[model samples]
Target: MQETPFCLRVGHLLPYSMLDSNITNFTKTSTFILLGIPGLEAAHVWISIPFCTMYAIAILGNFTILFIVKREPSLHGPMYYFLCMLAITDLVLSTSILPKMLAIFWFNSREIDFSACLTQMYFIHCFSAMESGIFVAMAFDRYVAICDPLRHSITLTNPVVAKIGLAVVLRGIMLILPYPLLARRWPYCRTSIIPHSYCEHIALVKLACTDIRISSYYSLSVAFFVIGLDVVFITMSYTQILRAIFSLPTKDARLKALGTCSSHLCVILAFYIPTLFSSLLHRFGHNVPLHLHILIANMYLLVPPMLNPIIYGMRTKQICNRLLWLVTRKGT
Candidate 1:
């Protein structure tokens, strides 16, 4: 005659056994409670406002980039093609987390079904990897355009660009597919409360009852391998491009060459700096505040998407001119 569990005792007090059935159903469904930015629960409504605003801006900006690029025949070059892919990736990457994040913040709805959580986790990471790959492709585009101007068009032809896009997608899928599959097999016997806004891999893995070293190590390995390799490639391309630019006789020629890459460089920094900072904080910042980590994580997703289009629109002369033309036309 052991004492009944407190949960069951509470369940017994409810009419029609509703609480009992809900508990039973929740157990079967295995939902995870997202405690979005813990220790700041009181300010969730206030927090939601900025997040919602950024999300709206990201959506509008990215869609405008896509629309402008598609409608403008002059923008049908390799560089703009990669920009289009990037805008699409940014849209997917931001949309995958922001809506659910906003929901958690605005409505206090935090229960995410386990499978749905895994799906969200996959999309977020997958698109992030894809975005990185796209950046690499863009860096290469600049390299070819500046360093090997003669071969720029012949090298990154439409077919080549299409192939590169496919490779980027496949690489992201292949690298991230293991995350959800492995996570699904692990037993989440511990508390289902995740302290972050989204189903981040490490945060989810921490809930497993058994050894999670494999998952942890694999994630570290993939991050290093993918990001490390891409950074190396981009750095190498830029080094050559710099050398090539310096070789130009006129200062204006060098300036023009560097100007072509200004937008890409800005976008790359916007994407990678916060990402690496967030990753390092997660792995090594034992004394760092949880809210800081969560805020950085959310910002990495939101800031890049919101800023990429704006950066391109302002820095890339063609896009800026076209955007102005469209606005002026609409005004009249």
Candidate 2:
């Protein structure tokens, strides 16, 4: 029979005064539990409500971008093609995690099985890497359009763009494949309660009974490879773009080039900054509150996807006008 804690059964065990006294003398260690949102019960029905709303907005916004690109013949170009890929990535990225997150929140039980957790981790990392890769491709496309406008169409032709898209998908798959395999190999002899909401590789690795040195090294290496290298490449692309823009003889051409790039740059910054902060907090902020970590994680997932379409819509006059025209015609 399992021994019960004195506080939990004090009145019922009062008949055994000696045992009760012994139990009262014992000290317990307090471990952290994922209580989800504070001030709410463990199974609060409204816990999932906020995520559901965000998920809906993300879906609607990205779908609108997709529709605008498809419907407007004038928007057919290498830049818009890259934007479409980004919208598609955002849709897949949000869909991969939000449904399960919502289910746990609404049901008041944030329970996920081992297999499901690993799968979630895999898709999350995969899409995140893919987004990074696609951002690099977008920057390159912009560079070609502005720095080599006459050759832009010939350079980023349909076949070439399709190959670049394939490269992004392949790179994402290669980068994230190791994490799940390494996780599965670990002998999980410790407690299974994941302190965070999702199955993050670092968070889950912290629970493994096996030596995590290899896993940690690999995870950090991949983070540096994807995040660090991609940032450097993006910076280089923009530097060349700036140099080329300044060399332009006409002000109108300069403004047009800058305008084309402004939206993409805004979305890239929105996605990358939060992602870098989240990765840093996850790795180094072990002493921070669980809720703070959870908040950062949500921002990392939702902000990029949410802001992507908004950035494109507000900045791209062509896309904005097409959307407006569609709505106006519908009203008429």
Index of the highest-TM-score prediction: 1
**Candidate 2 runs further than 4 Å off:** 1-49
Q: How many steric clashes between backbone atoms does each model show?
A: 0, 0
lDDT of each: 0.87, 0.78
Q: Pairs clashing in candidate 2?
A: none
Candidate 1 lDDT over residue span 243-321, tens digit each: 9999999999989988988889999999899999999998888777787888899999999999999999999999999
lDDT by residue for model 2 (1-332), tens: 56653322111222244334322211122121232443334544665666777788889889999999998889888788888999999998898777766655665566666777778889899989999999999999999888888998899998999999999999999989999889877765444555556677777766666698988999889999998999999999999999999888999988988998999899988999999888888767767665667768877897788889988998999999999999999999
| Clashes (candidate 1) | 0
Off by over 4 Å in 1: 1-28
Overlapping backbone residue pairs in candidate 2 total 0
Model 1 — TM-score against the truth? 0.92
